[model samples]
Target chain A: MNIGILLKEGPYNHQASDTAYKFAEAAIKKGHTIDAVFFYNDGVNNSTGNMEPPQDDRHIGNRWVGLCQKNNVKMMVCIAAAKRRGINDDVLIDCGEITGLGNLTDIAIRNDRLVTFGD
Target chain B: MEEFDDDEIVKKIMHVMRNAPHGTIYTYEGLEMILIMAAYDQDISVAFVDDGVYALKKGQDTAGIEVKGFAKTFLALDGYDVEKLYVDQVSLEERGLTEDDLVVDVEVISSAEIGKMMTEQDVVIQH
Candidate 1:
């Protein structure tokens, strides 16, 4: 199975992020394939690289990054949302480079299920 | 050119609505089955909108119910190559939410644009 996990919200705001990751992990465990992890809208924060959860808490961003790395999943962040939130692979700020809808189109063309997590 | 199934050619966009407590889940679940079948057999697209967006919410706590992980099953859609996920901008705003509130990166479009997208598609399934 090939899966596309779309993350729109941040780590703490909703269960979408965790839910998507859980799906991804379970799919891989079950020998499924993950096509891409597209991060659009607030979902871009998944790759902000500046998220800091307490030491005892789960570092969702890191976990996601690690999961993608382990599974060789294509992790895509919405350029627009990333820029709006100042999220980048290396840091987070008030403003940064933006992602475009075209990127989403590209992913849509290749993957099977474009699962979204938002509220 | 190769022939296509008329029923399969129609692009069906399934909007997953898990927020509503009652009959909504069944509605969305039915839509999910349809989308999965369409995408698995043909080409179909789905968008998760509004509070319905959380239907794909991660870390789903379905402890009380015996329902299989609907969100988890979503990750398997790629096997069918159905990969279009869109969210409504107005819905998010109306709920005092921004992209940051969702779990995945989804295409955020306005109501007008959503309507337009719907028209272009062969089918639109909202739960």
Candidate 2:
């Protein structure tokens, strides 16, 4: 099955992002293909490649990027949402980058299932 | 991959358009996400009721506070194949608004019609 996961928050303040990753990993183990992972609202912060974690903390951003890279999943952050949250490739924040909703729409149009986890 | 019947699979997306005096970034964001999801499945319908009607309202001024341009993006739903846009009649009446107040071309229906539409989907996401 092709599944699209929507993560609407980052890890530091919400659990939705973490929950989405866990589900993604499990789904892949079950042989499901993660067509895309789209971020909206505050969730767009997950795409900042410049996230900073303390020495004692987990690299949450890296984890999400790694998961998508490992699984060949398309990580999409809503352009409008990302800009509002001040997250984009040119802005210099951390895990992900700016992407158009067109990217998200493409994934949605092709995926068999669309599941969103938000707070 | 396991084969499944398309008829057996249903997709339902409920959009929450909060037009509160303070405005809600999350609500609009949620709708955008649902729109992306609906664009993928032909069966997906986006229903906006209550405060959700504000989502399609034009002339938003959420500047200086860092809110995104949602109304503009919302106008692109039809190109994505998301043809079903619903607005509740009661919601509009309560707010003293009419179809002219909205930014998009929506099908204004009663709450009952919205309920019936929900029954057709396999999953429902209410933002």
DockQ of each: 0.02, 0.23
Q: How would you class the docking of model 1?
A: incorrect
Model 1 misplaced regions, further than 4 Å? A89-99, B1-127
Chain A TM-scores in order: 0.85, 0.87
What DockQ does candidate 2 score? 0.23
Residue-level error in angstroms, candidate 2, position A112: 0.7
The stretch of ten residues in a row with the least summed lDDT in candidate 2 chain A is A88-97
For this target, which candidate reaches the highest TM-score against the unseen true structure? 2
TM-score of chain B of 2: 0.78
Looking at model 2, residue B41 earns an lDDT score of 55
**What value does the lDDT take at residue A32 in candidate 1?**
86
